[model samples]
Target: MQLLKDQERSQRAIKALIITPISLFIMISGFLLLKDNHFSQVATTLFAIVWGTVSVVSFFYSLNLIVQVFPLKYYNKIIPFVFVGPAILILGWYLFIPTLRSLYLSFLNRNSTAFVGLENYKYVFTDRTMLISFRNTILWLLFGTLFSVFFGLLAALLAERSSIEKIGKTFVFLPMAISMVGAGVIWKFMYAYKPAGANQTGLFNALMVAFGKDPQNWIGTAPMNNFFLIAIFVWLQTGFALVVLSAALKGVPNEIEEAARIDGASEFAVLMRIIIPSIAGSILTVATTILLAALKTFDIVFSMTNGLYGTEVLASQQYKQMFKFLNYGRGSAIAIIILLAVSPVIYYNLKEFNKREVF
Candidate 1:
């Protein structure tokens, strides 16, 4: 039995080595052929689709064959890896490799020809525009996230008790369907400024005119303009928060609320003590998700203010450094900074998700 088992193991190992290389060669060759420019666009697309489908099926079939050759005792141990291993490798290739390359580039000069040590990082911390971006990003993180979660929670609660729940939610959620740039354009018209004497086209300016006040440049006003930009983020993200929190609210048991009320707890107390706590996990999840969005906000600032009027955020600064100014080092440094800033929140979010068994 032992000699037979050894022979089986040798056979399986040889088969595995042979099958792996052949499968990879075929997949890679097919991919190259599909990518060749000799093919027309339509032919390339059709070939790519067919090639991808065939490659996936063939790879899985080969993987299953390899797994089956292994003894039954090892089948369970290897099966999970057989399926998940490809994804892990793909992620490492795509995400991890690029990240390391960026880190290396961050230490180099603008054109990545020479080493700059920490100079780029110092510029990121001390530059005047970068300072403004940091301040604005903080405002976005605090106010944008706060208002989105607050209003979303309020809307969810109100909608839960209202007769026109669907209609109200539909209206409130409509802004989420619009792209961030589109929203900025729409709101730009709403915030459009004209000379005090000219007819106000903007809704806010028109309101000011109706009240006999001066028409203000909403996007051009410093400090206060930051809040207006933050408002756009809130409008875009609140619907997402509302939908998530609304589902969480439904998951709370009605029995707990009734019991608290029967024990003479007021509505406010019951809500604060019972309902909110019950769905606290979901709320944290929503808040963290929005927090990430706020941290990475670029489109609204880009479209509306172009980072002008003191509305610069981290992402906008990164864009300016990388694309506009072509400073790879500074851009990579700023990107790493943003990554560090959001990593802790992401960790916490994933931890909460794990506690809830969301995976």
Candidate 2:
């Protein structure tokens, strides 16, 4: 009873010590407002300085006491909180609070003063730019990620154990190292045009002229331009998907492949039945990753097409709203849409991971 009492007393003492300086700082800062004009400014700055200084000092003191109070035997259990507490607080401050604030802002008018209810969300559904944004977003979701995953998986299967596999893989994975902006710049040049004989710097137009065809503005067309930009994203991301899927492919047991061959399975049949099924988990992981990347894509589209030719995605549209149009409410609505859309992806990925752990 005495030992338990002593422990409880020490804990209470430590907690009190930890909170005392924080309370003092707040009180002193509040009291500084009562001073005269010149004195008040000086007092306020000093109050801020003192508040910051004392807070840091108190935090370290509290941490030191916490380490000493918790025994070495229980340190492992206690250390995680010490390490993760600041991160959790920061996440709450930056992610959770900002997200809640944005959602609240979304319900307000453009100036963020009036309660506009669902006007902003309604604009998202009905506005021409937003409708185009949704259509382009769907195209990116369907074609951008799908082609990357498909080509990646196909490449993984094709290059499994060939003699030149390493060289082929090195070539394929080269694009993953480049930044999205750099990839866009490179492809921009590739699709460049200058009205038939004004230097022919653009590779696509150059190729066309070589075939005696007129130089055309490739990135200015309607649906075709969208696909061309999507192809750039597909090229950049396929390398990442290929590398991960190929690693998973390499993990498949040799006995399984040999058994399939012994059963007189065709090469294609073996790949379809034995290999793909075995790596389904990895495939799903890669596909989900690519889909998420596609959903959040802004830099590639902004750098390449600048969301022109009716190619605005949700991310670019969010930027266009907030920065170009200066409509914070609509911008926040678009941001919330993206957050909600990604929340499901994130939840599914987490659930999938949990399922994998169980199996």
Best by TM-score: 1
- Model 1: runs farther than 4 Å from truth? 1-26, 37-50
What does candidate 1's lDDT look like per residue over 1-359, in tens digits? 98898788788878777887778887999877866667889988888888888789779877976886778789889999989999999999998898898899999999999998999999999999999999999999999999999999999999999999999999889999999999999999999999989988999999999998999998898999999988999999999989999999999899989998999999999889988998888888898999999999999999999999999999999999999999999999999999999999999988887886889
lDDT of 2 by residue, 175-289 (tens): 9899999999999999987976677998889888989999988888887788888898899888888999999988989898999899899989988898899899888888888
Worst 10 residues of 2 by lDDT: 30-39
TM-score for all predictions? 0.88, 0.81
Model 1 residue pairs with clashes:
none
The TM-score of predicted model 1 comes to: 0.88
Runs in model 2 lying further than 4 Å from the true structure? 1-65, 71-77
| Full-model lDDT for every candidate | 0.92, 0.85
Candidate 2: C-alpha lDDT: 0.85
Best by lDDT: 1
